[model samples]
Target: MLNSLLRISQKTALTLVFGLFSGLASAQATTYYFSNSGNDSNKGTSISAPKKSLAAATALAKAGNKLLFKRGDAWYIPFGLFDLSNKSGTRNNPVIIDAYGAGDKPVISNLNVLSDDGWENIIGTTTWKHAIYGYSKALRLFANGVSKYKVNTSDKLANETDVDQPHEWFIKEGVINKNGIVYMNTGSSLVAPKNVEVLMVGSKPVVLMENTNYFTFRNIDFRGGSTSNIVNIWAPSANITFDSCIIQQGAGSGIQAGHSGQGDLTTYVANINILNCLVDKVWSDYENDPNILLSGDGIFMLHAVEGGLVQGNKILNWGHSGISITSYILGVHGVHNLIVEMNDVSGGESAYTHAIDMNGFEGLTTHNIIRRNYFHDYTVTGHILGSYNQIYSNIFAGVTVTKMPRHSHQGWGVDWAVWRYRGTGPWIEAHHNYLVNNTFVSTEECAIMIQDSKANPIAVSNNVIANNIIYNFGDIAIDVNTNVAGTVIVQHNNFWQENSTEPVARFKNLGTKDVYNAAELNLVLPQYFRGNTQFNPRFTDVAKRNFTLTESSPTALKYGGTTQYTSLLGEDFVDYFGKKWDPFKPSMGAIQYNGGD
Candidate 1:
């Protein structure tokens, strides 16, 4: 009887240990936390009970776990990696890692891991040590041994240390001691230090999704530091949505899809919706390094099987183009509905590039609608290189295309073209686009310049350009120079307050020119410039120099038109001082002047 009782007790103890181990193994969901003052085993559930690092929580978290961070707690992660590669979760049950507690607004501060010595090394080698050029390069070369050096076209120097093998170094200190000791004092002499600048190194992408599906990242903030992309959704990540997040300060693009190499290409990014997000301040380390070229874009949708919707987002301040769509080099075409609407894009000119760019080859960018957005204050062209596209209802202000001598090259202005490949294809319809009532203020050259020089058989027809208010422009409002074999129409456009001394409409060898061309060709310019009046447009308060049209002004009901104008003169217009103004009727210009009190 005693022996039997002891056996039962040992079996019960073994059973309890087995249960605990099983629970640890199948921990499918759990809550974790992070705090600077916390240890690795501190429950990791809340602010008071937090984990020491994000890595510690992520390692143990399963598919349906929540890695909640403490609010207002700043962490310094030098080179952290949150690998969600092997984890698979449903859309309803996603792995949520977010800031928690205190109204759930976590401020994840970006950690600057590099020291001053490292920064000095990067600046010296890249010739970015000083704001001005040439002088910085010369100083770097002299410090690194000019006798073994060679200068490149961009004034960057290269040299060999012991043998003829190429080596580069920057001056960390201006002076050096005879004992070969390195100090922070001035006049430090030449020697390649063991510590190099922490250049962001990985091209593997910060958030890489491979052979994964049904994923969603919401309300997360991805701050920048490393050289890798913020998010890389390869062919495997189909049916993904990134909503209401801030993806900023990435060394590469904010979001990049598709691989660059030629392979089996089994993975294809499709059904992706990036909505209500802010993708801004995406720059490249190559911008500082003269040896490398900046190739990626802010949102690169390449070779997608079913194109997606990119809406309600502000994509600004990028190193390269804002948005780019293209086909693979192996002639694999992908299409079906790409809708880019209601986006506010600006400041895409780091090296004189575009804000929104699309390059489609033999694939269709068809049924794509780019409408109702505000693109302004851009140093380069706002839009470029698209086909079968509908571009309408957009307000373009302060768009400078001309390359001023001191700023950029002059030939790099915005030219709306079908493709850069010069492939002979038919021109698509650019019609009913309320290029009207939108403002084009302080533009360097043509507001709407169209070029169809590629002997492509495409025609530009049924396009309506009417009642647009243009002011302080440097060149013609509409300039079409195309070899298109079809009849292109331009009618009922209001070219108001143009600063160009040239003709408003310049067409090359097209028979069906009307309106102003009609008198020259013995036909009427098909539209009316009637009660649609233009003056200083009577901005309210002369001291403020506001441009909002008042109610009793001539622009009120004076806009005589049968077709409904999409934009009123000042539809949701605001002054520089953030004052709101509305016009009485559809005002004739881009800005509706509200009359003074």
Candidate 2:
């Protein structure tokens, strides 16, 4: 029988060559060093003696280790909480926690550890000295002992004027009463009890990963502290990465992930990648009403986060909405691949804000991509106010939107009807987004607001509101209101109203506007248009608000119609201020402000 099949193929080729050389010698690559002055019993082996916290080298790191630290080391380590759960690393041995040598040196400070030993006043100091007395009662705050504030009230007061009064106090308990005292009508702010003495001596979180997976955090520098998040990453974390870190201040956030409580299935944090980081200020520690300062949000992703990539960060002085990816309540869900590219958000000193606030989430902010960013002085720059959020090629300067009144004597028409019912959820699909060739000099209102309320139909098709160049004072450039049945298809845009007596486009309908082509079911009307060549985009200098358009400006190439752009590159036509339109003559509107020969 052919010599017994050649001895069973030579014993299966020597067991596949010894299992590929023992998996290439067990993939070796380990390097640890923190040295806040070494010796956690040494032998972390660099030359036989290196380990000094990062929680003793992340508890003897595994999957292709590499901890580093050193460079100017301030290490600190006391007000604890650095849980990275099971821990893992791949993508060629990732698991780095960098920072060693080279400029910006080293300075990890406090690391959340604060215990000057005080606070044993066990609820004393004249009964917690009127910083907050707790009415609707439900205040939870923690650090080393873990818990990071959780207020739930029906009525609560310690003294920030009996919870700032105007009535909304649902309070339930989780008060640390820091006492910097600004809590009027409580929605955020009151931190400063010396930054709650580093979460009252390590109550919890200064980096805590729940169901861990591949991770990487480079160039660290998480200063000051109040914690609710300075990198939280909850749920089953997938391939996570945070490079060039700096995440500042922190009363509540500078990078956070999933599970805003109230669960089921518990979808873990998905493939996250936050690059070139540097978030600033950061607030929201909880006082609920001393006079109202509350409001702290900067990169917070909740619910079921899927593939996320928030690139090149440089967020600034935020107190709310500088990047909020939510899925807030009701059966809780989130989907689609999300991406917020090349970021450079700015000073959003909150008062009803947005520098990028995608809410409720569905179809995962649809084909998400907010590219080439550089938004300025934000109050509202790219807020798809929650349904199908897809904003592209950004670059807005001095953006503003102040309609206020959520409850302070309420009226900006009830704050635009509470900002149009804040969109109740699930409508997503704001198509081919390319808020075309951007450049807004000084906005105060209406830069872009597409309304569709009949229970969210969200299909604002083929968007390329081309070559934008606005400088409005009170609103109206593109505002579509579809009170019911919904379908917002505002075509081939190019509006230049540098205060050219306002009004460029506005369509009103409290109801009765029909548009249904559900593949030939027929009955369309709701289609507002104002095609190319409507004149006056001329502003080489609108009194220093310069909106760039003057070259016999009738808005140049004078838009025609054949609208179908998912960011067509070859035909030139690049508007939002980067100018370039007319690739062989096809420049009508939506940017191509003549860079094209």
Best by lDDT: 2
**RMSD in angstroms, all models?**
14.7, 21.1
TM-score of each: 0.65, 0.33
True-structure lDDT of candidate 1:
0.47
Runs in model 2 with CA error above 4 Å?
1-32, 35-48, 51-74, 77-112, 116-119, 122-142, 145-249, 252-286, 300-308, 311-319, 322-338, 341-355, 358-382, 385-522, 525-597
- Residue-level lDDT of model 1, residues 1-597, one tens digit each, is 211111111110000011111222234667777766789978776668778775685575565677776665645443454455555555445556666666434433232222334323222332222111111112112121111122231443422121122333222222221111111212223433232222122223446665555556666666543454667776655556677777765555777766444565544566667777788754322233334344446777776545676766777766556766655344444433566655667665344446666545443444454544555556565543334544544556666652323343322224444543433343332322224444455567766666554445444433444445554555455566746443444433444452212245556645555213212321333332232323333434323323344665444323432234444322323222222323323344434343434
RMSD of 1: 14.7
TM-score of 1: 0.65
Clashes of 2: 65
